[model samples]
Target chain A: MLEIKGLKAKVEGKEILHGIDLAVPAGEVHAIMGPNGSGKSTLGYVLAGREGYEVTDGQALFKGRDILALEPEERAAAGLFLAFQYPVELPGVTNATFLKSALNAVRKARGEGELDAMQFLKRVRGIMKSLGMAEDMLKRGVNVGFSGGEKKRNEILQMAVLEPRLAVLDETDSGLDIDAMRIVADGVNALRGPGRAMLVITHYQRLLDYIVPDRVHVLMGGRIVRSGGPELARELEQKGYGSLPAAA
Target chain B: MARTAQTSRVTAPAPALAAQLARYAGLKDRLAGAGLPWLRDLREAAAQALAANGLPTPRTEAWRFTNLRPLHDLSFAEPVALVGSEAERAALALLPALGRWRAVLVDGRFRADLSELDGLPEGLAVQPLASALHAGAAGLDGLLGTLARPDQEPMAALNTALMEDGVIVRVAPGVKVAERLEVVSIASAPAERAIAFHPRLLVTLGADASLILVDTALGAGAAAYLNNPVAEVDLAPGASLDHVRVQDEGPAALHLATVYARVAERARYESFTLSLGARLARNEVHVTLAGADGDCSVHGAYLAHGQRHIDNTSIIRHAAPACRSRQVYKGVLKDQSHGVFQGKIEVDQIAQKTDGYQMNQAILLSPEAEVNSKPQLEIYADDVKCSHGATVGELDEAQLFYLRSRGVPAEEARAILVQAFFGDALEQVPDEGLREALSALIAGWWEREGGAG
Candidate 1:
C-alpha cells in the first residue's frame, strides 16, 4: 500500500533521513522504533508533505502514485493521514466542522458522495461511542484545551472518521498513560482491515503490546539498521537500543 | 479625549481641517435648528473648539499611523445637494431588512417612506432630527450635546455645526424594548463629484429601560464620499443598552463615526463594532461610567483588505466607585491594507474598586500589510484592577499545516484561522442573531476578497 525508497530528507538545510527504504503491504501494520532525534518523526512529516521538510533525493509512493509531489491537503485527499504528536489548537473552529470538511474533501477526491449533516452526525456519533469520547467533544474547538490523552484520542477519532487508506501515527503514545494508550490502540486496531495500512512510530514498546505490529524496524542514525518481527520490539525493550548490534 | 494629548500645547490646524472650517463657514446658516439660541450657541462653541484643536491627522498624538490625505484630495458636495433617485432609494431600502424596527437615512435625510416605524410599541419613540429640532420639542433639554464633546472630537464638532438630519431614539422610564431597533445610514454623491454628510443620532434611555440599537453605515456607489456620524447616548440608572455598529461602505468611501455614551448607576453600555469596508475609516467611541456599579464593554473586529485603512479608537472612563469597563478589539489586514487600534481605560480618583481590562490584537496576512495597536490604561484610584495587552502577528505556520493535513484546502484553512482569530471579539455581541449576522458578513468578506489569496 505504501513504498519509500532512497528517501533522503532535510530540515533547515541539514539532512535528517538518509537513504530510507521501506514498504508496507495492504492489511499490514509496520512499526518503526527509534530513540530520541532518530528521524522517525521527520520521516512521517516528509511523507505527509509538510513544508520545510525538503526532500533532496527520494520518492514516496502511496497506492502506486507519487505523493511527494502533492500538497498536504492533496496528499490527504489521496488517502494519507498523519496523526501529529502535538496537535495544534484551533481556537474557534469546532471539531465537527473540521471533521466534516475533512471527510467531505476526502470523499470528493475519491469520487464518492459527501455526507450530509444527519448522516455525518450518525457516523461520527457511532465512532465516538466506540472510542469512548464525549459527545460534546464535537461542539468544542479543535484540540483546544484537550488533555494529552484526549488529544491522542481525538487524533484517532479523526482517523476513524476520515477512514484514510494509510495513516502515519507520529508518536501518538508519547504523553498517554497506560489506559489512554490502550484506548488509542483499540481505536487504531478497529480500523485495521485488508484495504488499510498503518505506519506506527514510537519511542517505547508499551504501545506495541496493545496494537501488535506485523513487522518492526529499528531506525537509528537516520537509517533502518534492523528489520524483524513482533519479538524484536520486546527484545529491544528488554535490551535497549544501545546494546543491539547494528545490522544495516 | 481622555487619553488624547489636548490643552497642554496647541499647533496650527492642518490644511484639510482649515478647508473643512471654511466649508462650515459657508454652510453655517443652513444648519439644523439655526433659529434656536441654545443650538446656535452650542454650534458656535463647538466650532470655536474645533478651530483651536483642529481635526485629527497623522501627526496628531493618538491619530498617528492613519493617513487622512485622501480626504483633502477630494472636493465634497454638501448634503443638501444630494438627491437620490427612485432606483437608488429602492437599492437602499433593501439594506436594513433584518426584520425589526428600522429607520433609513439617505445622505442625512430621513426617509419616512422607507423606514419601518409604524408598529412601534407604546413606550418607544423614533423621530427624525427635523422634528426634534422644531419648536415645542421638549426632550432635547440636556441629551443632545451632552455626551459627544465638540471641543474634544473635531469630527463630532464638524457634525455638530453641519448636522442636517438623523434619528432621535427614546424609551420611556421602566420600559423594556423587546425588539431590536436599527438605524441605517447610506452615503451617495452626484455624478463625478464626491459628497460628505454629517448625521446626528440621539439615544436616551430612562431609568431601568433597556434597548438594543443596531446602527449601520453603508455607501451607495463608488464615489469617494464621506459618511461622518456623531451619536450621543445617555443611559439612566439601571438602564441597559446594546449598541451594534456596522460600517460597510463603498470602495472609495470614508467613514468616520463617533459615539459618546454616559452610563449611570448600575447601568450597562455594551457596544460591538464591525468595520468591514471603506477606503479610509475611523470609528471612535468614548464612554463614561458616571454612577456607581456601572459597567461597559467596547469590543469590535476590523477587517481591512485591498489597500484599505481602518481604525478603531476608544476611551472608557470610570467616574464613579466600583465601575467596570473592558475593551477588546481584533483586526485582520490583507494585501497592502493597514489597521490601527488605540484603546484606553481611565479610572478616576474617587472610582475606587474599579475593574478594567483592555486587549488589542491584529493579524497581517501579507508582508506589506501593517498594524498599529496601542492599549493604554490610566488609573488614579489605588484599589483598582486594571490590565492591558496587545499583539501583532502573522498566522502560525504549524497551525496552518495542522489544518491542511486534515484535508481542508489551503484557502479554506486560512479563512477558518482568520475567523477564529476574530472569534473572541465577535463573541461579545450580546444577541445571537446579530452575532450570526456579523459572522456571516465576515465570511462574505473573506469570499469576496478571494479567501486569503
Candidate 2:
C-alpha cells in the first residue's frame, strides 16, 4: 500500500532522511525501531505532507500515486493519517467540533453526505468512551489542558474516527502508562484488516507485545540497518540495538 | 496672479467655523437659565477650555496614534431632528434586545415611548437627564464631571459642551437590580448631509447595589456622522457591576467614546468593550479603584476589517491599598485595516498588595494589515504584582498545518483559529446570544474578506 525510493528529505537546508527506501504491503503492521535523531518523526512528517519539510530528492508513492506533490489536506483526504507524537492544543475549538469538521471535510471530499450535530456527537462520544476519555473533554477545547497520556489517547481516538488506509504512529508509546499502552495497542489492533497498512514507530519493544508487528526494522543513522521478524524485537529488548551488526 | 490666489487661500481664516465656535460659547448662559445651576459653571469652563485648545491635532501625544486627516475637512451642522419613521422604528426594534431595562436614544434624542421601565424597585431611579435637572437634585452636578475627564480628548470635551438629554439610573442603598439596564443609541441621518450627536449617560449604584449596562450603537448611509458618547458610572461601597460596551457604527461614522468609572470600598467592576465599526473610532475607558479591597476586570475585542480604524486606550488606577485589576484586549485586523491598543495601570505608593495583569494580542490577516499595541505599567508600590505582555503575529503555521492535516479546509481552519484568538474576550460577555451573534458576524466577515494574503 506504500512505497518509498531513496527518500531524501531536508529541513532548513540540512538533509535529515538520506536515502531511505522502504515498502509495506496491505494488512501488515511494520515497526520502525530507531534511536533518537534517526529521522523517525521526520519520516512521519514527510509522509503526512507537512509543510516546511523540503523534499530534496525522493519519491513517496501511496496507493501507486506520487504523494510528495499533494497538500497535507489532500493527502489526508487520500487516506493518509499521521498520529502526531505531540498533539497541538487548540484552546477555543472543542474536540467534538474539531473532529466533526475534519470528518465532514473528508466526507465531502469523498462526495458523501454530511453528519448533523446529533449524528456527529454520537459518533465522537462512542469513540471517546472507548478511549476512556471523559464526555466533558469533548466540550472543552481540543487538547488544551490534556495530560501527556491523554493527548496520545486523543490521537488514537482521531485515528479510529478517520479510519485512514495507511496510519503512521510516531512514538505513540513514549508517555503512555502500561494500561494506556495496552488500550492504545488494542485500538490499533482492532483496526487491523485486509487492504489496510500501519507503520508503528517506537523506541521501546514493549508496545509490540500488545500489537505484534509482522516485521521489525532496525533504523540507525537515517537508514534501515536490519530487517527481521517478531523475535528480533524480543532480542533487542533482552540485549539492545548496540548488539546488532552494522549494515555495510 | 496664481501666487496671489494661493496666498489668499493660505491666509484666509475660516470665519464660518469660528462663528460655530462662538455659537457654542454662548450656550453656557442659556444653560444657566435652563436650570441645573451646578452644571452651568462646568459647562462654561469646558467651553472656554475647548476654545483655547481648539480641536486635537494629530501631533498631540494622546492623538498621535490616530490621524484625523479625514475628519479635518468634515463639515457638521448642529444636531438635527430625530428622523426615524414608524417603519424605520419597527425595523430597528427587531434587532437584539438587551437585558430588561431598555432605554432607546434615536438620532441623539431620548425616546421614552420606545423604552420600558415600569416597576423599578424603590430607591432605584431611572430617569432622563433633563428631568433630573428639573428635579433640583443636589447630587446631579457633584457627580457629573467626576468620571468623564474633559481635557483628555477633544471630542469628549465637545460632547460635554453640546450634550443634549441622556439617561440617569441610580440604585438605592443595599438594593440590587435583578435585570440589566440596556442603553441603545441609534443614529439615522435621514438628511442628505452628515452631522454630529453626543449622548451622555450617568449610572450610580448605591452601597451594596449592583447592575449591568450594555451600550450598543448603529447607524446608516455614508453620512459623516460623529458619535461622541460618554458614560459615567459610580459604584458605592461593596457595589458590583458587569458593563459591556458594543460599538457597531456605520462605515462612514466617526465614533469617540469615553467610559469613566469609580469603585468604592470592596466594590467589583467588570467591563468589556467590543469595537467593530466606523471609518475611524477611538474608545477611551478610565477606571479608578478609590477604596480598599476593590477588584476590576477590563476586557476588549476590536474586529476591524476593510479600511476601518479602531483605537482603544484604557487606564486603570489603583489608588487604595489591596486592590486588583486585570486588562486583556485582542484585535483581528484584515484588509488595509488598522488597530491600536494602549493600556496602562498606575499603582500609587500607598496602594500595597496591588495585583495587576495586562495582556494584548493582535492577529493581522493580510500583509497590509497593521496593529500597534502598547501595554504600560506604572507601579510605585513595593508590595505589588504587575505584569504586561503584548504579541503581534500571524496565525501559527504549525497549528494550521495540524488542523488541515485532519481534513479541515484552509479557510475554515483559519476562521477557527481566529475565533479561538477572540474566544477569551467573547467569553467575558454575559449574554450568550450576543456572543454567538458576534462570533457569527466574525465568520461572515472572514468569508466576505476571501483569502488573507
Candidate 3:
C-alpha cells in the first residue's frame, strides 16, 4: 500500500535520509529499528509532507499515486497518517474541537456528509473508552498539560478516529512506561485489519513484543542495511546492532 | 499657561493645540450645560490644561511609539446635528444584540427615538448626560469629570472641554441590575469634512451593587471624523462592575477613548476592550483600587490590518492594602498596520500585600507589520508582588504544521491558532453571552482580513 524508491531527503542543507527503498504491502505490519539520528523520524516527516525537509530525489507512492507532491492536509485526506513522537500542545483549543475539525475536513474532502456534534461525541466516547482515556480529556485543551503516556495514547486515539489506510508510528513507545506501552499496543492491535498497513518505527525491540510485526528491518547510517523476519528483532536484542555483519 | 508649561518642564503645546483652542473657542458657548456656572468653570479649566499640554507627540515619553502626526495635520470641524438615517439604522442592526437595555447615540447626541429605556428596574437610573445636567441631578455634580485627570490625559481633557452628550447610568445601594446595559455610539458625519465630537459617560454603582456595561463604538459612512469619548466609573464598597467596550469605527475615522474607574473596598472591576477598525485608535484605561481587598482586571484584544493603527494603554494603581489587579492585552497586525501596548502597574507604599500582574503579547502576520510592547511595574511597598511581561512573535510553524497535518487547511489552521491566541484575553470576559458575542466579532474580522492571504 505504501512504496518509497530511492527516497533521498535533507533538512537545512544536511542530508538526513540517503538513497533508500522500502515497501509495506496491504495488511502487513513492518518495523524499522534504528539508533539515534538514523533518519527514522525524518522518513515519517517526509512522508507526511512536512515543510523544511527537501526531497532532492526519489518519489513516495501511496496507492500508485505520487504522495510527495501533495500538501499535508491533502495527504491526510488520502488516508495517510503520521503519529508524531511528540504531540503538539494547542492551548485554548479543546481536544473535541480539534478532532471534530480534522474529522470533518477529511470527511468533506472525501465527499462524505459531516457529522453533527452529538454524532461526533458518540463516536469519540467509544474510542475514548477503549483507549482508557477519561471523558474530561476531551474537554481540556489539546495535550496542554497531558502526561507523556497520555500524549502517546492521544496520538493513537487520533489514529483510530481517522482510520487511515496506512499509518506511520514514529517512536510512539519511546517515553511510555510498560503499562502505557501495553495500552498503546492494544490500541494499535485493535486497528489491525486486512485493509490497513502500519510501519512501527522504534529504537528498542521491547515495543515489538506486544504488537508483533510481520517483518523487521534494521536502519543504520540513514539506509536499511538488513531485512529479515520477526526473529531479526530478537536476534538484534540479543546481539546489539554493533555485532551485526557489515552490509554487502 | 505658558509659565506653567515652562516651570513644569513640559513640552510646549504644538500648533495643533492652538488650532483646537481656536475651534473650541467657537463652540464653547454651544457646549452642553453651558449655562451651569460650575460646568462652565470645569470646561474652562480643562481647556487650559489641554492648551498647556498640547497633543501628545512621538517625542513625549508616554507617546513614544504612537505618532499623532496624522491627527495633527487634519483640521476637525465641529460636529453637526445628525438624525439616524436608513443606512445608519442598517449599520446599527448589524451590531450584536447581546444586551437588553440599549441606548443609542448618533453623532455624539443621544437618539431618544432609537433608545429603549422602558421597563428599567427600580433603584436604577439611566438617562442622557444632557438631560441629567439639565435636571441638575443630585449626585451628578461631583461625578462628572472627577475620576479622569486632565493633566495626564490630554485627549480626555479635550473631551471634557467640548463634551457634547453621552449616557449616565446609576444603580442605587444594594441593587443588582441583572440585564446588561449597552451604550452604542455611531458616528455619521455630514459630508467628507473631518468632524469631531466628545461624548462623556458617567457610571456609578452604589455599595453592594452589581452591573454590566457594554460600550460599542461604530460608524456608518466612510467620511473622515473623530470619535473621542471619556467614561468615568465609580464603584462603591463591595460593588462589582463588568465593562466591555468594542471599537469598530469606520475605516476613515479616528477613535480615541479614555475610561477612568475607581474601585472601592472589596469591590471588583473587570473591563475588556476589543479594537477592530479605524484609521488610528487609542483606548486608554486608568483604574485605581482605592479600598482594601479590591480586585481589578483589564484585558483587551486588538486586530489591525491595512494601514490601521491601534494602541492600548492602561495604568493600574493599588492604593489600598491587599488589592489585586491583572492586565492582559493581545494584538494581531497584518499588512503595514501598527500596534502598541503600554501597561503600567503602580503599588503605593501604604498598599501592603498588594498583588499585580501584567502581560502583553502580539503576533505580526506581515514583515512590514509592527508592534511595540512596554510593560512597567512600579512597587514602593516591600510586601507587594508585581510581575509584568511582553512578547512579540510570529505564528508557531510547528503548531501550524500539526494542525494542517490533521487535515485542517492552512487558512483554517491559521484562523484557529489566531483565535486561540486571542482566547486567552477573551476568557476574561465575566459574562458568557458577551464573550460569545465578542468572539463572533473577532471571527468576522479574521474572515475578512485573514482569509486566503
Query: Quick one: best DockQ, which candidate?
Result: 1
Q: lDDT of all the models against the reference?
A: 0.88, 0.82, 0.90
| Tens-digit per-residue lDDT, B1-453, candidate 3 | 988968665554556787888877887887778878888888888899888778888878888988888788888887666645886688888887868889989888899988888888997888999887767655667788889788778998899898878999999999999998899998885566888889999999999999999999998888778899999999999999999999999998889899999999999999999999899999999999999999999999999999999999999999999999999999999999999999999989989999999999999999999998888888899998898898999999889999889888889999999999999799899888998999999999999888754
> Which 10-residue span in candidate 3 chain B carries the lowest summed lDDT?
B7-16
Q: Residue A93 in model 2: shift from native, Å?
A: 2.8
Writing each residue's lDDT as its tens digit, candidate 1 over A78-177 gives: 8999999988898898999889988987888788999999999999999999888999999999999999999999999999999899999999999998
* Candidate 1 Cα outliers beyond 4 Å, as residue runs: A245-248, B1-15, B80-87, B90-96, B450-452
lDDT of 2 by residue, B1-453 (tens): 999999985455334335436656665555322556557766666665666655666667777778866656777766565554673475366556667778878766688877777777677788777566666755776777777777666666776777767788788888877777788877775457777777888889889988877778777545678788888989999998888877877788988888888998899899888877788998888899999999998888888888889989889999999999989998888889999888999999989999999988998888899988878889889999999999999888888989998988888899889888888778877668667866776666667654655
* Model with the higher TM-score, candidate 2 or 3: 3
Query: What are the interface RMSDs of all the models?
Result: 0.9, 0.8, 0.5
Native-to-model Cα distance after best TM-score fit, residue B421 in candidate 3, in Å: 1.6
DockQ of each: 0.82, 0.73, 0.79
Query: Per-residue lDDT for B60-146 in model 1, tens only?
Result: 786787777888677677765545467457557556365378898888878887778989998899999976686545768566788
Most lDDT-accurate candidate: 3
In terms of docking quality, model 2 is medium
Clashing pairs in 2: none
Off by over 4 Å in 3: A245-248, B1-15, B189-191
lDDT of 3: 0.90
Estimated TM-score for each candidate: 0.96, 0.90, 0.96
